[model samples]
Target: MNYSATAPYVWDPNFADAPDCLLSADQCVIQAQHYFVKGLIEIPVIGSDEVFSWGVWVSLSRENFSRAADLWDTPGRESEKPYFGWLTTELTIYSPTTINLKTNLHTRPVGERPLIELEPTDHPLAVEQRVGITMDRVREIAESLLHGARSESG
Candidate 1:
């Protein structure tokens, strides 16, 4: 089945009420193309008052989503990191809002399955710093997005 053709855009739960600009995947086109589960998360800091933020935009093919769903219900999905294919691109930082700092991820991968390079590199957020997301949540968001989109289209 063509998942992208069926799915709608899924906004981050925290930013559901916020403007679409702050969302990482708001710019994505879900049609005959790929589908994505996107979210933004605040990086917790212990010391200073400056707020840091991170965003995750995981791109999934229809087949990949099915595989991920199976793995999600399995006991040890965590060990299989990068369970879903992701949009690999630079992390963009936007000016702070009155409430908190914001970050956006816009990745339109040129190749197939460009999993992020996760190492202790110069990147602002390390692999460990990347937010933990479950495959179950991914499926939930996609389903919600698709259902909403279908409702509107009808």
Candidate 2:
């Protein structure tokens, strides 16, 4: 299963036309101040080889952002250290907000999106990442997103 956010949570459509801002399929810069990168928050599926993933964005420091961009097309970029960032996408299916979660963006091979590793916290999303989620949970999330359910409780 896969879900995605097209841009950062703070993205403004007007930024698209601003000379100082940039919005692309895998990267974003708002007002040339806020840097963001798209990555995957993957969860293992219990009893299956399949994985569930959220194609989300995370805000990064200017230095980290520059470093990532410099290595964008470089082979073996996956060996580079992960960049610290804050989760910018809101996964409405989770309660108590899914924004601002701590994350580490691990760059992958040239063609793949970076991997987002959430901090090991008590948050349900983090817990699910650390442990594995069942297929039933995946279906629940899919249903929630597909039906526009506001939160997991719904």
Candidate 3:
């Protein structure tokens, strides 16, 4: 209704991390509020202000991945094509160290009376901003999970 009053602040986040329009509208809204109050100041606010997003090392959200696949199902128009692949917003401010994050998803099939149930396990996924993440992080998590299952097997 009032463009002047609303024009004081605008939201501009580096969506270099987000590949698609998914469950991050709130993040952008908060960033807009942060700018409204701070007036173009580059400061990392505590308690999840406009800090780096958390999409750097996580598996691409199913929605984004599907969108990318559909959009890029052709070639020769790659550059002009919009990029909607992977979770790009998530980043690790501190990386190249032994620290990492990982997760596991397991499912068990049940009988006719019961459907399938899913179980999730997580671990540290090692990553480097320069080169990105490697399979070691996944393997580490999987191995740890396997070891746990083995220990509990017998």
RMSD, every candidate, angstroms: 15.0, 2.9, 19.9
Lowest lDDT 10-mer window, candidate 2?
A: 145-154
**Each prediction's whole-model lDDT (CA):** 0.38, 0.95, 0.25
Q: Against the hidden reference, what TM-scores do the models get?
A: 0.32, 0.95, 0.20
Predicted candidate 1 versus true structure: per-residue lDDT over 68-92, tens digit per residue: 5455345544445453344332232
Q: What is the lDDT of candidate 2?
A: 0.95
CA deviation > 4 Å runs, candidate 1: 1-29, 39-55, 61-63, 88-120, 126-154
Q: Write the per-residue lDDT of candidate 3 for residues 1-154, one digit (tens) a residue.
A: 0001111112234432444422231122222122111001012223333321121222223543344334433443233322222122222222332122232111112211111111122212222222233344434435654676688696
- The candidate, 1 or 2, that scores higher on lDDT is 2
Error of 1 at 102 (Å): 20
Best by lDDT: 2
User: Which 10-residue window in model 1 sums to the lowest lDDT?
Assistant: 92-101
Error of 1 at 84 (Å): 6.4
Model 3 lowest lDDT segment of ten: 110-119
Best first by TM-score, ranked: 2, 1, 3
TM-score of 3: 0.20
Clashing pairs in 1: none
